[model samples]
Target: MTRQTGAGAPGSPRVAGAPARLAARFSARLEKWLEAERTQLPLWLPVGGVAGVAAWFWLPAPAAWQGFLLLAAALALPGLVFGRGGRIGRAVALFALAAAIGCGLIWWKAARADGAALPHAVVAAFTARIDRVEPLPARASVRLTLHPLMVAPDPRGGAIALPGRIRLTVPLEDAVAGLAPGATLAARARLVPPPSAAVPGAYDYAAVAWFAGIGATGKALAPVRLIAPAPAGGPSLWLADARIALTAHILSELPPGEGGVAAALATGDMGAVTQDDNNAFRNSGLAHLLSVSGLHLTAAVGATMVLALRLLALWPRLALRAPLLLIAAGCGGVVGIAYTLLTGAEVPTVRSLVAALVVLAGIALGREAMTLRLVATGALVCVLFWPESVAGPSFQLSFAAILSIVALHELPWTRRMFEKREEGHVRRLLREVAALLLTGLVVEAALAPIAIFHFHRAGLYGAAANIVAIPLTTFVIMPAEALALLFDSVGLGAAFWWVTGRALALLLAIAHHVGSLPGAVTFVPTMSRLAFASIMAGGLWLALWRTRARLFGLLPVAIGLVMTLAAHPADIFVTGDGRHLAVRAPDGQVALLRQRTGDYMRDTLSELSGREGDEAIALDDLPGARCGPDSCAATLVRGDRIWHLLATRSPYRIDRPAMEQACAAADIVASDRRLPGWCRPRWLKADAALLAGTGGLAISLVRPAVVTVAAMQGQHPWALHAAARPAGAIHGSYRRFSQADEARHHSRNRWRD
Candidate 1:
């Protein structure tokens, strides 16, 4: 009664207890969420690993010791969390540890992959042993993966050290006889360092090459002389030789256009496929069929298992003595492994093979297969070994598509809706079609953002196209090709080959027709990393979570799409070498400063601006543009300002006086040659000196700023080439491990160890 005057007021009991009640409620909710996500824990293990790999790639020049320190800290997290925190803390700690391990592994791989960087390009004669051979019959060339043995002395009277591996595009006439792996050859070639990104924030081919252990690329200048024939040894060599033979056999047996598709499906070689065909497939959403991935692997394994089971059933005594299912599973797994190895063992194929083998093992062990868990396991394994692949489109697209499909099937309602029951044939067929349609739509939606992020476009009709394309490729083309290959040895495969060709022709026709439909492709301007990241996060959330709370993921996804739509693409674009320039006028039309530039450059510019190459009009055709033989002057209006641009067309000598006057009057200048200080523009002077430092240039008048490739690509080992530095500045411990240098200096090659 006395406390009621102060602490114990009339409603004090309810108010004071409110805090405790809220705390209890919050704790209960968190525990409920945890319980709900209990089965979802394993899925996040790979997510953490992928996040770690992504962090490594995105961070600028991460030190090895830093990763080790992070690993140590992450390892200690579990102990501290276990002692002081609850289940949620323990889960977070485990996830942190997985991320740290992923980061550490990728860091180690990157360090190991580091090799000598070529200071500058040089055309010289070199001797190298071929490590691999890729036939590009469509391009009238053969690509050789070479291990450099010797290079002729440079013009400055010094030996040139080549990297451990280099790719040379040898013309059909320049390629030597028996130009296969394990053969040594001498050739004149233009050896150059890996090319950098074309524009700011574009794809970094240099980084990809670096991770692949390819330090340089070149084109053969003259015919190569084979010093030695291919040795009849090495498993990789045998595979390469066999792949070449298989590709040739497929192409030889089938008709021309259809054979390229056939060979691609059979051997995972797309060199024979023409650019037009590739584009058609890509636009029609049938491009995945060309890539030997989970679909092909599953089909092959299933076919083999069915055939094995049928054959084993014929031998009733043997079938009784052994478990037929286990035996069939074993046979299927063996055939799958063989096929994977035969087809180059690419990342996607290997990932599929791993999952297939796991499923087969589950069958043999009489265990239920958890599809989503199996996908997670395969992804985690691939991330552990090929961490760099996490950054690639192939890895992202394949995993995203599969995860979405599996997650769709994992939903309770989805299972109920598709549950098998006694029904008429028409009902069953309709149910199957509906299931396929739903799956295709889910996969397409999941893959759209990724496709747009990489290709700057998404196929609108992909799902509809796949309804016809998939069954044609799977049930007809794959099985026919398999039978054709089997019967080829007995010289009775002609009929099967004809069937295969007809199926492929129909597939290609479907692709072309679908691709030609109006609005088949939706082009999007280049999106920012943040937008892409948000989309990725939301997609993972939606795919990983099984509860209704997963619907919350749509918030970030919608935000990302809005951001992408509201983005403002740069109005001015310049190549890294300053040899090309493009300007987008106020009317939303683009014009090229040079009419003579190649199609590749034009296409690149068009894609970046979210337009087709054919849609870009000539600079001279623009209303406010005037042109001459060696230069062009243009005016662009953005917002309230009028900007003037002067761009030189020729790389050779220009009229210096006229250029200087024009530069003084213009707001922006672009030239391939080094310009004098007096020729400076008011805003930008994109001459050789400036372009060398910037790498590439993208100017946005709306933002009134410029973005450079060098700035976007941070100072990584692969990007050091883009930095303006002396040629001799690149001589470091990394180059000391070069095979060519080690042979002469007789020093330790730590890379080998």
Candidate 2:
């Protein structure tokens, strides 16, 4: 009648065996999941390797020995437990091995790229060979990347050597003096070490430059003297000459705007394209067309293959004697390689080239094509050869777009849409349209997080734009352009050129119309690494996994989205030199500390503050700001606390009484020069010395915290160089130009600068 004893109770035996029961159930489910993912497991090898590369990049100061040790342990793991553990164990070992290899690859690559960085800013006259030239007509400048052959002796009879490649921004007229690759030049330039990130979590151009073997960058003091003409011997020189010639021919055939776009599509030269067109393409999500990646390369290869096959079939003897499909595939492969090389062989183009070649090989061998395995192979090759590329947007976005498309089609439902079936032309057309739309949507969704992470904005209507732009470019413009080039030698390409120009005009019009639509671009605040990592992990899980378990990925993806939405930007943004400062007022509008601001500074601050579209009001214009000749005092109210900020407007010292009173009353003080001992801020003192090491500052009022680029970057080599200025030398400025900007400039010069 009363409570039962332990052994007699109904739940006692079950409780006693719960651990064993749970273990058995878990093992059964694990084994089931492993079997379903057996084929997919190899696909994750690249993911693991990329993760290792990311780990290496993110670590404070990762060492080669660490990578080596990790790799050794991973290789020995399967061997150590051979025939002991089940499928789960083997999978773990495989992933670990892949990650270790990635880490090791980056370390080795970094070691090779390492060189002595410029000590500090110096005005030295040096003779150098032009490795590359970029024409930035928009800025009226030409950027030259050079390998120093000799440096003239210092005025004081001292000597210095430019250890690695250096980039100089020269006046457009000056660049014309010696503006070709492989040409020799002599010029006096104000060279400084590569700058660090402008803001925490912003793109680190310094890291990229370091890996690219560029130790210093500067501006030319005067026009460069042509020491020697471009010597034509090397393959690089030949490619450069050919690319320039081709771009020039296309430009000459077409009108200004259309010609620039055509040249970009044909030869990967975006130099002549106006910024307005660039913006439209970006906003409309048609930006991918401008980038010579999967879509362009695939279309080129496909066109070549089809044309070759048709021409061969015309000769019945050759068709009957040869493996026509293999021949076509071989033709496609050659065209893919040639197109890639002609397009400058950028990271994305190269990645696409490798993938296209793989697909062509599959066609030749009659193997399953357009699968995740093919994508994995392409990714593996990229990570192996250019492991650092895994961290860049080009590699991430290119691979993600392809992976998503392939994965979507791999689904049984989607595969049915592509499989041949008997139907009316209208019905078939509708199905194809729907499939393209679906693919666009899938690609848009897949690329959103990465786009937002790198650019702080994602195209909201990319799918809709791509629906029209893709076919327009692939079928109409590119093919027409190719044919025009082909018949141009016989002077019969005028009509074709006209057709290509018209198609391009339509494409540009579409981009402008779609990009101008409301909410075409969705701007988000700077996302934390953790949140981005979560989204990446979730996306990979969803895309890679085949079973219902993949739905679990939605949890992390949702969480990451929420985290991103909830993230708040810092209240104040300050440049390292204290020449520019921005603050968010109590009214939620950003205010500038100075009356004037550079375009680069303004845009960077806007993006960092998550208000890309908003115009910044000057400090004196704001209600709670008081400004004078030497400094500006502003009030930023967050919740119940009011923060008093005193920012210097000029290098000259302010009035003693005014400075003392401002410092005494202020909660934060920001100046480029050292402050007096008697003047102190309650929260932080961000002066020249402190900012030098930090590179830039993002101040938060809510928690009263400061996040520096140094802290965000940790003790990486690129970051360390910012704090290593030589004695009596001028300090290097914060990031002045992004790699993308430089690349655009270089492209302009690469082809008829």
Candidate 3:
């Protein structure tokens, strides 16, 4: 056949027309979508706020110069766009502005966190004033925030000025003169740097500590002696004193555990509640009650409004002349502010207060309070002020639950159902029960993915638990607590507290009973980030859009669920400290190489593996494992391949005999000591230096003969401080091993006796 030429070529016309046609179609669609999206600009504002927070978190901590440049660019771009550009341009500018604000806030926060931390553990004498004191629940220890006046190397050494604050966990026995805010004390303390994350993408303790202005975490080495007592009757000490007094009064009125719960609900001090009680509430799906969040705040404010209105009714002159609803909303606002302050103004509490105030403002303006626009506005305010909270579980979960509930309630069908009137008491009661059930289901569904992502567990009976728990908390426990606070101002609190305690005891019993049910808790394996993102996107789409197009959001949800189901656990896990190693055996149970240390990391591994409890298993529990005084070894068999892991605690000098034995018996060796020269070229080894730099390690056995390794500290902000190996080191090592294995025809006898 003759070759094609010119315009008559076989595929020329088709190929040439395709680009033109595709460009025309794409341009048309883009224009149409932009026009529609422009009308929903208010809805997109919260999205822009979220984007800003995400941009801040995704980027590495910027240098001071880079931060300034970012701020300049951010400011200049918005100004230029707003001045010269059209609607689309203005929207773009707004998004950029919001993102810039987030970046700037994080940068400023990071700069403030540059205080000196003790690199190694050291016992030093320190004189400091307590800034705040929080008691640990059911523990004899109390956490104190201290501002250092002077830190001495020893009794003879010169004073050292320490910047930022220190968190001291002092045992009650060591608090000889009693501890309170503004009390100056001198004591010996063992101080160290804040801990880093134990596993990748887990809680960042160091980052939280940095943001909270805590430079170091330490324990008091001796009894703390009061150098100066707190001043008498000052506004600065009033809130703290009141909180302490309230907590003590409640405890005095009720039994230990029950009183602790009451105090936590009323004053936001959870120190008295035992760990068992906390776990019971958490597992029972009623944990929200313990935290003074939106639910509690709304309940308190509503009760205050009711009480205010009833009292207003006694003075019929004012009730007839004024708009009672507006007056009630104003009263609620004042009460909400007081409650917020009384609860220490935590991030969640503040966010809830903002939402409540927005509602009151809406009532005063003769507009609906539960609109999406108002919710978005509240969220925007929170993100602007406390951008760091965007990364926290409380912010994410609370917002998710509230947004979902509001969105569901605003649905046409739901609204219509509420609009229908029922006359009889039985009918009204039934309607109320149905509404509660639906609300519980919607909230649970919306927050389930976030719960699983952060905690790796979901409350299976949460909806049922909430059904029984919500009414009791809302009507009995919260109202009684508020009443107790009121009566306590007049020295009649003991009677009210006694009543509140009885109600709390009943609530706790319900939580315990519900939490004890079989399958109340369901463990979920770690979901991939991509899967989580998809689920969140789908949820947002469903919640924000008010059209049938929202049905398409289910597509991403399905895809995410499929991805989650196919995900598998890593084959091996090692701790950041190089103290413990866990390998998946043939039967899929994790085998431990060391028993005592890295309990936290071990528990994390267990949870990720879908194991029931976080308890550590003994080395001898594994098949073909041996432990010595200074070393331990284990063999994990998967299919036909046997993988060896060895851990030793000796110093960095090479032990020739041990090296030979390890190399002869294992495919990989993990040790504190450096490997001998001959062994380095033969086996895959992770030494103390590598572990210290990488933070932790996870390995996947792609096949019986091929293994892949990933580092936990891969390019994270915390990892940047450590001395890093070249980016390609892990892949290069794997490649070299793969090449060798292929050359030897996958022989098991590559290392001979």
Top candidate (lDDT)? 1
Give the TM-score comparing model 1 with the true structure, all chains together: 0.92
Off by over 4 Å in 1: 1-24, 61-85, 725-753
- Per-residue lDDT of 182-267 in model 1, one digit per residue for the tens? 99999989988888888875677888888888988999988999999988988888889999999999989877789889989999
* Residue range with the least summed lDDT across 10 consecutive positions in model 2: 726-735
Q: Which segments of model 3 are wrong by more than 4 Å?
A: 1-40, 60-93, 114-116, 154-163, 488-495, 586-588, 591-602, 614-616, 649-655, 671-684, 703-753
Q: Is candidate 2 or candidate 3 better by TM-score?
A: 2
Candidate 3 CA-lDDT value: 0.72
Q: For all the candidates, what are their Cα RMSDs to the real structure?
A: 9.7, 8.5, 4.7
The Cα local distance difference test for each model comes to 0.82, 0.80, 0.72
In order of listing, the candidates' clash counts read 0, 3, 1
lDDT of 3 by residue, 609-658 (tens): 56544544666687767666666666555544455656665454535775
Q: Where does the lowest 10-residue lDDT sum fall in candidate 3? A: 704-713
